[model samples]
Target: MTMYSTDTPVNGQDQEVPPFGTAPIPGSRGEEKRAHLQARRTEDRADRREAAEERRRDREHKRRMKTEAKNAKVGLALQKKAERQKLRAKRRKERAGRLVELREKLSHHMPLWGLPVVLVSLAVGASGQADAALAAGMGWASGGVPILTEGMTLTLAGLTAQAIEQRRPHGWLMRATWATATGAAAINAAGHYIAGVEDGADKALYRAVLYAGASMLGLVLWWIVMRSKRAAISGRSAEETTRWKRLARRHPVLVRRARRVVDNTGLSLPEAYAMVWQRANGAAPGEPSIREIRASRRAAFKRTQAEAWDGRTRFSRTAPAPAVVVPAAVEPEPETVPELASEAAPELIPAPYLPVALAVPGLDGQWIAHRVPVHPLPAWRPCQEPGSETATTRFPQGQEPLPDPSPDASEDEDGTQPDEAQEQVREQVADDRLDKARALVEQAALEGRNLRRHPSNRQMARHLGCRPGTAREYLTQVLAERGIRR
Candidate 1:
């Protein structure tokens, strides 16, 4: 059996071809080409992979560098903040220490100087007291002499200081301190004088002065210190003392009363003074307190309420009279008219038209009361013609009817009719008022006020001190005289 392979000769070379369903031969040209192509793809993929790896590494490196830079900046900011906080803390501690030192110095400076003066006084006083006691023949009790003098003085002063510090009443304690201090100073001077009498008169005098000054110096210093401490505690400065002194001088009586109040009530001077002032000036003898006023108001309100509850009405409840209706143009027969009762008759009261004295500014700038006549409207009456049908009006009791208006009316003693004289006076007053109004308008115009516009009735009335209607009339006449239109 002859088995043939898929090989053919081409150009005098044997060409190996892969079978239809089999792989290519190991050393064939197709295998070599496929290998070359695969190798090219693998090299391309490896190059692309290396480029991607390099880019990833670069991104990581940049990210790490950025993170490190941010951390460094944060650490630097934190370091600066810590340094600032440390500096502030150090400054605060130093300031606190300085304040404490200042306070300690201020509080102790007085005692620091006072202690040395006290020690010197104690030594000098003890020597003086021992010598005095020895001269008095008290052998064993010579040491007790200083105890009675300087020791007693110091003890009393200390007690007085304690009383002042505690805000207790220390009047007697202060007096005792002064008495003991004076006695101790006297004793010290006497003892020194006795001891130096044998030396000479001048030596004795000098010893007395030295011993006395030494003994009193400590007491004086102590008194000053206590006074300063008391003033500080009570908030009474030199200015406050001067102010109180001035007030006391100004109001001695008030100060006396305030002192009494302070004694009785244990209140501060200001509080007591205020109390005394209120008692003296808040109200007069007849003036009531606010409590009394409120009580009176409440009583008045209760009385009013009681009156209301008892049906005691404030206004009258009586019915009004019926109205009389008269026709405008109708005439009634007198015999057919109903007669009105005495109680039902309406009184005819006239309007007030009396002459009033108006206070007006005169030429001298002083107010002068000028008499002005007020003209009233005339009363209306029925026609008194003969054969006229009109009802006669009734008059109230004890009243007279109006007189007839006729030319034959009586005249006054001055040879003039009363009505005529009244009319003339009214006209004269109107002329005077018109003149005053004109003067005022001219003055206003001269003062650069607009004269084209006239003042209103209220303003004119206020200026002229007259009624609005009268002022209006004066304004019209003044405007007419000036030739100004309405």
Candidate 2:
């Protein structure tokens, strides 16, 4: 059969014609091209499949890592929760142990635990008997007898105990408790006596005594317990108690004074006693008394005065004598001079002799006082003409006049006068005071004290030798400069 020719140009290359239904020759260009194309396609397909598998693997790995991280976080949270729970459990266990220890300590006091049982039994028996006795006379309406007698006693005793525990004064409550207990004992005895009166006198007496003893026994036991509790709570040593007792016996007056002090000041017995003893004994050894301090201040004042007197004496002895200025003889001009009238004649009024105490230095460096004339006003002088040469104008008899002071002597190089210099000195003093205040503030801060408080301000005033208000002002300025608030 005749077959069609399969000749075509593949990729712009000439290829040999092959008959239909026949395979191309091996190693031919067409065959090689097709083979190469198929191989490349397969390789590309394999590469795509490998890439897709790698992507899937990467996604799975990321998901696994995220899940592991989540699990680790949850585990850490659980661990922290467990640690917290464990810590809480440890605290609770420690608290329980402390409570157990406290309970054991409290249980060691046997009277504290046994007294209640004995008291309860006695109260129950006494109350029953009292109730029956009261009912015999007042019927069921007297059922409250037990409550009034036993209940009241127990209530007062409990209140006394509470007061003692709280460290409050309960003398009245204690007295009331004792009084109620006595009344209950008496009631119990009377009830028993009346009930046994039909039996015999002796038996009635015995019964009364027995019942009264029962009623009183509980109170005695309770009293012992209360005393024990009080002694334990007081925490006073036996030596201290003995010392206090000895002090009371030896010096009852002082003890009484101490007691009053304690009541007034709320101080403890030892502190009050010490205060009383110190006051009674005056100042302690090595400490100066008020009289001694006053004597010392007087001695210091005397020494200061003596030193000043000595300095003045030395200055007077060593100072140069004043120069006497003799007036030059000037010829008077022939001019008409007005003569004084008879009424205007100069009258020499004798200077009043005023007695003044003069401190004279003695040979032994002691001051001796002498009365001398030191008048306030000088002798009257007649008026003289201008340019007159008179001996009285130049020199006075038995008196040396003070020389005139030059105006320029008191001025500084900068022409600052005494007033301005004094002002500058005052400013410098203020600046020094400010510096001292700042130093004091720093010292107070180092010592952990705040000068803003009133007490601290008083202390600062004492240290600075100033008033508290002035010290407060200084502290305010210092704190303000440091940017500190009040």
Candidate 3:
């Protein structure tokens, strides 16, 4: 029981030994392996946490910088955009006046100075012709007006038969005498009517006589014209016979019939006329005169053309090559042209073929028929796609078939792709923006369901990353794009 301390003093330190296995669960060869692995794991986890914190800080900085850059761009872009809009508005106000000026410039057909002058010249010429006719009439009634100027007297004389026949008082003398007598009486009657304006009977009588003078001239000219026409027709028939003989020799089919008609009948003009008449009516009059034959020949010629060229279908060539046949034309014959009833036309008759000398003032000879080949129009070839073997509905849309690509568009010698680098960049940027906007819209839409249908538009705009008005426009555009009705 007496205290006797059994502890012994060691070095100057608190030296205490742990119990057998309670210390740190003592390490062995295998236990040391586990210790190293646990220590490594603790170190790795600390490094990962620091790395994650650095990445988050970096992302925050980048986001702030991007926001600032986009805000800066918005101000610069909006100012320029406002200037453009203002210019467009101002121009819109002036557009109506510009359109009016353009329309007026395109519409007026004539120059300011030209139209009135043409109208005036036409009026003056018409009046001058009428006045000349009236003055000529007055001169004729006043005993030929010997006091007239040379040109005026000539003009007046030309209006009557006296000057037309070389101013002779004979040969068609009856017509001129009649005109002179009637015209003179009219002048005498007018002289008697000068007392007062009683009934103006003398004026009326003078007018009638003046008309009679014109009528007498017209009648003589008409008779001469009829005679000339008959003579010309007779002469033409004779010419045709000679032409037919030449043409007949070149082709065999008509030659046989023509030779028989010529040799068997002697083919005098009168006999030819009779034969031609018989062909027309299927019978000839007994001992027909030369005139009857001429009439019949013309009728038959016209009838033949009707049967040959009209809808009877003979006009068209039946065989690919026209059949060669002898001509039926008669040999050339001496046929006299009867004199014209109107004597004046005969003066120019001999020179009629010389168009420059004999042509009426406005006539030209170019209208004469000439032989030429006429080709038929080409057949239409429908467009067909290769291999498909079906004609394309080429005009289904309002587009012409694409012609072959131009030579300039051929591939380059180097085989390099065409440079669309800028377009690629724009498209890539658009894709990125659209993806981000879609993500934002989806998030906003989910939040709206938890809140209300019509959220703050500005809040929605912020989610869209666009201005309020732009967001409104986009909303409208999207609804339309979705084909939604209001």
TM-scores, all models, native as reference: 0.35, 0.35, 0.15
Q: Which candidate number has the best lDDT?
A: 1
Candidate 1 weakest ten by summed lDDT:
388-397
Model 3 / residue 155 / CA error / Å: 11
**Candidate 1 deviant stretches above 4 angstroms:** 1-110, 249-257, 277-486
Q: What's the lDDT of the predicted structure labeled candidate 2?
A: 0.68
lDDT (Cα, tens digit) per residue for candidate 1, span 1-486:
673332335655544444457776558796687557666877988999999999999999999999999999999999999999999999999999999887665343246656888878878878887888888899999989898787787778777877887878778898998888777777778888999999998999899889988887877887788778888888877877777787788789988878867866799888787676656656322344344444444555555558756443559585455578886986875777677758767767664322444454332224666443332434434575553143433332343444333466787688877556655655666666677788888887788876666566666776766778878888877877778756
Candidate 2's clash total is: 0
For residues 1-486, what per-residue lDDT tens digits would candidate 3 score against the true structure?
573222322453222333455665555896566557656766888899989999998899899999999998998899899999998888986897788776553223223343354234323322333334344566443433322222232233334332233322223444544454344334333333332225677665564444334333433443354344334544556666555455456434434444445544566444554455455435443433345434544555555557775343446655355558999999999999976577654553331121122111111112322122122334335675444233432221233443333325655476533333323444554454445444544565676542223334454465555566655554544444435433
lDDT of 2 by residue, 299-385 (tens): 555555677553335437574555789999999989988876577677577743223444543322246664443234333356743
In model 2, which regions exceed 4 Å deviation? 1-121, 124-136, 249-257, 275-486
lDDT of 2 at 145: 79
lDDT of each: 0.71, 0.68, 0.45
In candidate 3, what residue range of length 10 has the lowest lDDT sum? 357-366
